[model samples]
Target: MTYRDFPMPAGLRRTVPGGSETGGPEAGGTVAEPAPAKASATVMLLRPGTGTDGLELFVLKRAATMAFAANMLAFPGGGVDPRDADPDVPWAGPDPQEWARRMDTSVEQARELVIAAAREVFEECGVLLAGPDAGSIVADLTDPVWDEERDALLSREQSFAELLIRRNLVLRTDLLSLRAHWITPELQPKRFNTRFFVARLPEGQIADDRSSEATEVLWAAPEQLLAANDAGEHRMLPPTRVMIEQLARAASLDDALRPAERVWPVLPAPVEHDDALWMRAPIDEDGNGLPPTVAARNGDRPQGELPVMTPWTGGPLNERVTCTLCPNPSPMTLEGTNTWILSAPGADEAVVIDPGPLDEEHLQQVLTDVAARGARVGLVLFTHEHWDHAQSLERFGELTGAPLRGNFPGAEPVTDGELFEIGGLRLRTVLTPGHTMASVCFLLEEDGILFTGDTILGRGTTVVAHPDGQLSAYLDTLEKIADLTTGSVTTLAPGHGPVLPDAAATVRQYADHRQERLAQVREATVGQQDRPRSELADLVVAEVYAEVPRNVWPAARQSVLAQLDYLDAGS
Candidate 1:
């Protein structure tokens, strides 16, 4: 059946916002949606490339059975846990009160959410954002006391304040930067007021993904992976999908990082179209320091209000999300990420690329966009298997009754060179393995929009992770993309960051960067005694990337090991 006929889940009736729980038939049947809630704080983690080439991000595929965005790709983060607000969590960077004000939340709630972000990141991704002084109450991360203390906080057994005083640990509040904010939409049953914060991974610790809510995890370069997802190859969540699109627009992780330093104002999804939903550079109440397009659309119109929608205001028609990093989408506020709606010319139906994270409000927003176009989603496309890119695969498919499409080898694996048409646009899949064994790239034949999932990017090189990712395979993929330059493959629409005009040159730069890193790695290991892969990496990274943060050393070591393996295999 087409999406219009897709049956809603049992008990999935719309509700009026002001209705009583057990009153009128309308209350039990359907009710007006409540305004979305506003949340404070977003936490993002970054890892240096495991390969010698560039940086990557930690991502995970949420289990399909999850209540939130079932079977979607996502970064490691969630709402703030109560302990996050504890003053005892230890503050290192910015004050929690200031953070709350910047995020537009109460100081107490802000503290908790930040704490929760830190706690959740460690629990889900195996990366530690907390510092060493955890407390005399808790010996060390490995110590049983530490586990007990952590569990007590996680389980709500002990207050964060108690734990803080019991242990001398302090929260490194300075480490976090205000990245973005997203309010849940008014149409959905489950909602969250989420804050996005960006932080670099700690040095020496490896991201040990817990196989619970997240079935798998890995570090990936945005451009390369997004390229795959956009081609309907990889799956991703909305936030992850949009974040990568923004990352692709950056020239380097450093360039992308500049924005992280400034405190970003949190913007909520307009409850009613009449409610204001526009975002721009943070404004001071004195009516000064406003960026152009800051006040693009002000005034609560109504639910599903349409004002020449673009990625900056969610995304375009046919689920065509605009890259937040792109220059075209105006009055940009970090409402998470912008999604695109893809429609092939001459076709009545369209394909939804990067349905985005499994946010309840966002899902509704996409549906509104879809309804506005009077088009049904024919298929769902993923850039790659990264959580941020493909997290919403199942939900989008379920909601739209559209079949999932992609070439990556997984539960619903597609083959290389697969092509599908919708609304005059054509998405051709190209198997671009390296970021992961199943990575793929989609070339939009119509507009020269080549969606390279982690294969190529407008900025920064893609990482070649070991184990799941291989340097040899990634390099080969880069070469294959560069070869596209000889033909019509010109503009690159990556899964993460932004789109690129000179696709061929970008691919060439990626390849050269890898080669240069390889040379440095070889030189670093020339005189050192043989050591474990991780140990050897410590030596090599110090020589190759003295400029990168030290917290990413483990990932670097992984890259060096992958290279060593490639050399040993002589492939």
Candidate 2:
């Protein structure tokens, strides 16, 4: 219940070693039961200001020394004091019973949350929302007398109910609208069941950056703040970031005040991958990252930009198969690698393909899922040797003791067109190298889905990862995949990205993209035909990849080198 003023929990570091406050499960030891969440509240104070929507929000940069979410940009909020439930407190606007219905909490807890929201906003920003009566709001709170009262409240010298009693003021519950509820993930040392509120800036009163908890303060448009976050100026917690994103869609203050259809508490859990930890949380399917179930995006999505492939915990693709997405996300790994679990209807055994990155939590998740289905891992298969999809085989094999096969080290060698049967389902492996000499695809013959491992992807073209990836061999692999997809393979479940409906069409797109790149490379070598390989690769990247981000230019160069080799060999 009480954590010392440290950014990360001490016990967590002791057990998780390199882990931070991202709250990943302990790698080497048992984690203590998570502490209960303290009921808390925060408010997004809004007003008319610069930007397209003519709306701006008040924000504070928490002091770096804070125990939780240190140095993050946040709204004004604090925990509910036990005294906030005082029976004699002034009342106004919607009563606690109505709020209980709105906030999905007990009438008593709703009252406490509302009181905490008003009290913290006033205590932290010096702009009180209550007045002597329900009909009016307090104005001009910049005087020293008000400052003394704020200081008293901050130091707990006076409770919020006492301050309201002294001023003969009633809490303006109507001014605040319930926006969202977010519970801190259980992996945290300090957790909060936080109720979020949105309110307009009271007229004739100015908010000041006088809160002792904040080192800096600002008022910016929602879009501007998002741009800043994208540019890495200020870091925001997921809750705050999501709220601002919603606010950016507003055309006016009335649109901002519009009630939400529904609010669900989002709790983000940590998932480890790519030798690091990333937070995994659920998002609406239509809003942002269309979670890979999108059967056909080719006709819908824009030409150049890929749809937001938001990080997700993948779900069941059909009756016999499920994809558990790893929590790793990056430009290189779009929404992390996919780990497929295949079984028969009501079978007690399953086949797990690509256990994915050496994340202790992910491994446990896979095992838990297998057990949940009343099944044990009958076999483990790695599509390739790339560390992202293949490294955890040894640890996983130890845990499951299942047969290990496919392109990983110390696994049974897989030849082209080998059949791996499990749970009465036949999975035929088609050796489609190129991404690596060992890359392969698994055909779930019954379901008509081909799990393409890095040879093709859901979002964009697969990177032919240089010397290890030969362009000529990769082209052959694509052709082979295209031919096999016609008869029974209707869907493509790519190893790294989305699962699409038309497998054959996607393969053709990959082929077309490859040829386009080849043409670009040939054109780039117009006058520099005799240049060194490295120089030629760099030149091709500049000529062909000018529109792409510089961060990915290194990867583009590798692909260019492969194209150069393919071209040189042909000549």
Candidate 3:
């Protein structure tokens, strides 16, 4: 599938008038400011998969009558109850103080979140996460007496701790493991700071759709659920969708619950443009984010400092740069296209790089920001002719009445080492054609920043976009950019994601990754020299790129084909 065809999880933004990119109330809108997120907890109950299934998670479809996330598939969870904060409740297993350290919350709040998770699991799914003692779990909870207690708990006639005490059971805090923490976006009417936990379904108990809040319940493999969601047959919130994607990486319940030294909270920032909304999650150069699964697998530990993330809220990045993030975010574009404004200090004329797509609101926002900075657009430039990076070229030039330059057919052709001056700013075009034939990188001679376009992304590797994108040329471009990094290029102003601090290291890493992929492709295609090109590409993908998701293999196939072509030409 193409980048546009890739499915993205639905966001939670409610339609509002005069909303800005960050979903804050606009100047003339009557919409009230969003309220703070209420503390909540959720649990993903897992069990061994049957037949060809992998690990399956217990999920429920919320009733359509609910106030929030109505008619959506979700794990059992709810907001923390006031009674959940009661320290007098009977408990067992891990101490609340230890749980506090794990969850990055206060001891009282950690106790409440864990209690709420257990309470909601029983209240919604008829599976209690408690046992008679600290070392054991309740094997069976199907008795009618248990049903009465669950009903009473759900109705608030009795607290979860009270139910546990009456049944002579201890809340099994050790059974649950932290999966993730997601805060609802500010654009949504209702917000939640939900901590997600994963736990094994007790041996002798079954999860039943017993709660009035849910319309149905089922056990589904994580991959199957993701496929259904991708096919539009199932609907889920962004957090739920991302969690399921993470769960798909695990082969068993033990793998899914592997303990991590630290888990970073995923706070998806909201960006709105031209009536379209997206939740932008921060990711690294490999397009990998702090998904709990990734963290757990690598045993990542929180240190003194974490990687810096560029805010989705459009604003000045520095004295010479300003970034206005577009609202279109997908698997390929982490936070959306970063429309950059470059100007020298105290200069009244600025240069706009990569106008980005044809979104009128984004184009207008760029102009508004430029005017706000007491500057007029002096020149418009393109890094390549790819629609995402250059579609708005003429429109922006029309609006700013600035001269346009790029490697495109009609625009002023920029050659390697070609220099342009915008006020006191000096930019030299460096031809870097790997992503697209026309791709180029701009060097800010004085600022030590490189406008890398798609040749280098802030949060992931760029696709060679085979046929139009040559692997040999792309490799050369990576080396060329890496050589420049040895000098003054300290920061990378990429077309997507954030501004990277280590430009040279990133370039070298990109080159190394490309070489590794090339070697893998060469090895995978060995002794298949007589095979059809299409067949060879498929074999390469199956053997070399087997771990990549099938949805992305189409693009991967493109790169694989490019690699094969490179190898063939070399031979």
Candidate maximizing TM-score: 3
TM-score of each: 0.43, 0.47, 0.49
In model 3, the runs with Cα more than 4 Å from the true position are: 1-314
Higher-scoring candidate on TM-score, 1 or 3: 3
lDDT of 3 by residue, 232-276 (tens): 888898778778887888767788876554566655554433544
Write model 1 residue lDDT over 1-571, tens digit each, in one string: 0001112222212221211111101110122223234233445677666565356877777775454454566777765543455565566667877876776668887777777776666556555565545331211355446556656654556665566556655666565665665544333323456767677776666666544677777677877778777676567644455567666566666655544443333232322223423322122332122232342232423223422123223333224433322122211111233345666434467666666666656767677665566677777777666555566667777788887866453336677888776666677888888867777777777667677655553223455656778888888888888887789698776554445566765565456456656665665676564687667766666655443345445555566667777766765
Candidate 3 displacement at residue 206 in angstroms:
50
Model 3 CA lDDT for position 259 = 54
The local lDDT score (0 to 100) that residue 568 gets in candidate 1 is 61
Candidate 2 lDDT, 1-120, residue by residue in tens? 100011222222211111112111111111223434667999999999864557999999988555456578899997787778776789999999988898777999889899999999
Better lDDT candidate (1, 3) = 3
